[model samples]
Target chain A: MAEIVGAYFTSHVPSIGGAIHRGLKQDPYWKPFFDGFPPVHEWLAKVKPDVAVVFSNDHGLNFFLDKMPTFAVGAAPEYANADEGWGLPLYKTFKGHPELSWHIIEGLVEEEFDPVTCQSMLVDHAISIPFELAYPDAEQWPIKLVPIGINTVQHPLPSAKRCLALGRSVHKALASWKGDERIVVIGTGGLSHQLDGERAGFMNAEYDRFCLDNLVSDPDALTKDSIHEIVRLAGTQGVEVLNWIAARGALGPGAREIHRNYHLPISNTAAATVLYEPA
Target chain B: MPSELEPIPGTTLFDGEAARKGYALNALCFSFNEKVNRDAFLADEAAYLARFNLTPEQHEAIAKRDVLGMIAAGGNIYYLAKLAGIFGLNVQDVGSMQTGVSVDKFKAMLLAQGRGESYEVAHKEMLNG
Candidate 1:
């Protein structure tokens, strides 16, 4: 059976991609955020997992309002990243793990969680940025990918509770897999910042701190807040923390946090990176 | 009866109601992902916008480059971002535009929040103290 090695929770703010492209990591404004990743890189070097199952939200790149799926999982042989209208340079294509993706899709269905399965998906910065942050210099990415997109764009989003359940189902699927691949679950997006409305620049470090603490010690406690409450406490875009909640959920109970870094105002976001290993 | 969500101040929920209203506007912005579409839109803005079934208000909002106006006309920030990019406006630029602040001031506000200098955080500290 495949073993779930750990989980990573990160913020996928697109500007980070631009900064990397411009070689601005040491620039005073971006240094703190960039500084958070070296530890993650060292950890990845130490415990190399074979596959990464990423939980992220697409920012109008692949899916549109024409047909938005609450939850979509990728089963493609390869996933490509293209222009997201901001002129961020295209990233190298990612290899996929179709066999595991299919197993997880079936497991989600059996667990009463319906997910749209995609055999051809174009990943956006949400997946690309985090991968780049984790493996900054890889000529070719070391791990296979299984991208799971949760809808954070439109309202009527899956509750944090529901997202946690989805992650647990993923855990079950990975545990039951006939192969022995080591897997890491990644949840990308948010700590707290709103990019629209009169509250366009809203940032809540206090709420973000609360979430960071609770995400590890008491994930269920974090889920107690309804979607509306999360929007109020975090900001509108800050609600991307749903990706974090789902990633934490996949770690199962007794997961210990090994490392965490939080920095604010990373291009209209309170960026954070957390790594959790199963106890 | 379906319970209504209590509205958050200065925030639009982008629920079904807004999604339905903004479909054409969002669809138009979504097309900007391609360089050809971006160039086409730049060449003849009105004609390109006309290709979509945009509401009168949405069309006006785009014409004026009014960020808040676009939001009121049912634009989701995610999609509006693409349109903003076409005009070389980043989030901070539009943020300052909407908030009646300079870009530097808007950025300073964010830096203050990061440093725990915002009113909300200060108020919490006072209460706790």
Candidate 2:
């Protein structure tokens, strides 16, 4: 059976991808943000998960408002990274493990989750940014990917309780895989920062820290938080916290936070990163 | 009637109803993902919108460059950002437009809240009455 080697959570702000692409990592404004990833890099090197089941939300790449699937999983051989019309350079395609993806999808559907399955997709910065951060200097991504796309954009999104349940389903699915593979689960976006309305540029580091603490020590506390509460306090885009909640759920209760970093003001976001290992 | 669902103050919920209303306009905005399409739209705004067969309200909203109106007309913010990008408006600029404040003032309000301001209040005051 496949073993889940590690779980990680991080903010996938597009501008950080811009800094990495334009050779601006050393710039004073971005250095702190860039500095947080090296430990994560070290962790990835140590664990060396054969595949990463990434939990990220799309920012208008494939699904426009027309048919926003609350939970979608990519079951393709390769996933392309595309320009998001924001001038960021496209990264090389990441190889996908379709067999493993389908295993999880089947397990999810059996468990009553009903995740929308896609055979092709061009991922936006949410997927690309985290991929770049993990393997900064690779000619091609060194790790394979299975993307779990969620909807944190439009309203009436899946609830926190539902997201947590989905994560548990993902964990159960990974466990039932008969193949001999090691895997990691990753969630991206949020540690408090909003990107729209008069509340644009909202960053609550204290709330972010609270979230990080509970996410590690008492993540169940988070499931109690409602969509409105998160939106009002964390800013509307803060709904991406659901991605993190799902990752935490995938890691299961005994997973301990191994490394964490939180930083502020990265292009209208309060960024954070954490790694969880089975305790 | 008075029993209808109450709308959240200061926000537009892009739920199912709004998603249906804004589908065509958003699809038109989605087309701007390609640089060629963005350039085409910029070269002739009305012509580009006409291709989408947008409703008069959506066409008017696009013509006026009104973000809030577009949202009211069923425009998703993420898709609308493409249109906003064409006009060199960033998130803060959109927020300023939405709030009817200057960008500088809007930015200052964000700053006044403090970067580390943890939400101490309960959900009732923060989300609804």
Candidate 2 residue pairs in clash (backbone atoms < 3 Å): none
Clashes of each: 0, 0
lDDT string, candidate 2, A6-48, tens digits: 8988898877877887899989878878888899899889888
Candidate 1 docking class: medium
Alpha-carbon runs more than 4 Å astray in model 2: B1-9, B100-129
lDDT of 2 at A71: 99
- Lowest lDDT sum, 10 consecutive residues, model 1 chain A, at A197-206
Question: For model 2 chain A, where is the 10-residue window of minimal lDDT?
Answer: A194-203
* Pairs that clash in candidate 1: none
lDDT of model 2, residue B52: 84
lDDT score, candidate 2, position A48: 84
